[model samples]
Target: MANPDFEDLVETFEFLDDWEDRYRHVIDMGKAMPPLEEALKVPATKVDGCASQVWLVPKIADNVFTFRGESDAMIVRGLIAVLSALYNDQPVSDVMKIDAAAELGRLGLNDHLSAQRSNGLRAMVERIRETAAAAA
Candidate 1:
């Protein structure tokens, strides 16, 4: 099941008629995200396989999974926001159960994103899953 926040995003995407409008919406979401502190941008949090610089800092409490992420590219940052909506505040076990590709597919991201961006998104999802799995 998708998070309510993510579902809301999906609804918004459905309302938008064109890819350009959806793209702008995603960029706006990225612009709204709080920037991660420079201190948290260390090698430990840096995600590999991304064309742009990216970092994800996990904050697990009482088995709940949450993370804050940042990226140099606007689209990538938006992607982080989407992932946050999809996975944050969920139980660690539930995080592992999420079908990320299917959820993201609802946004038609795969059809629009460049190959490199798609790979980077997958890398981000993998990193999230790995972090959740370790915590579980």
Candidate 2:
């Protein structure tokens, strides 16, 4: 499952004039994510450090990692979607190469997010990187 969404998002973000519109687009991307089954929602998948409740589930097959995530707040959920595009459906080597912090900066999202949200976002990226490292 190779997701092509990240490049599209980057292109769209480049096209957008302001952060507000980009934020809206990010939210829309989250809204478009399919709802996870109740069975998959569990304590083990939960992502900590977020003001809002968030869950992330990672799966690996044939050396490719994919993720499923959910969050209580719309914005947080969108952030999860953004993370999915950034991290999911990739080889362990590729995932290991990503500097999640710098990549978020490239997206111009770090400056706009609240401090709490920023910490939460960083936590999420750390979790993904850890998962990738384990699988790698």
lDDT of 2: 0.86
Candidate 1, superposed: residue stretches over 4 Å from native: none
Worst 10 residues of 2 by lDDT: 1-10
Cα lDDT tens digits for candidate 1, 1-136: 7889999999999999999999999999999999999999999999999999999999999999999999999999999999999998899999989999999999999999999999999999999999999988
Q: Residue 100: error of model 1 in Å?
A: 0.5
Q: Pick the candidate with the highest lDDT.
A: 1
User: Residue by residue across 32-121, what tens digits does model 2's lDDT show?
Assistant: 888777888898888889899988989999998889998878998899999998888788778878777776777899889999999999
In angstroms, the error of model 1 at 16 is: 0.6
Instruction: For candidate 1, list the clashing residue pairs, or say none.
Output: none
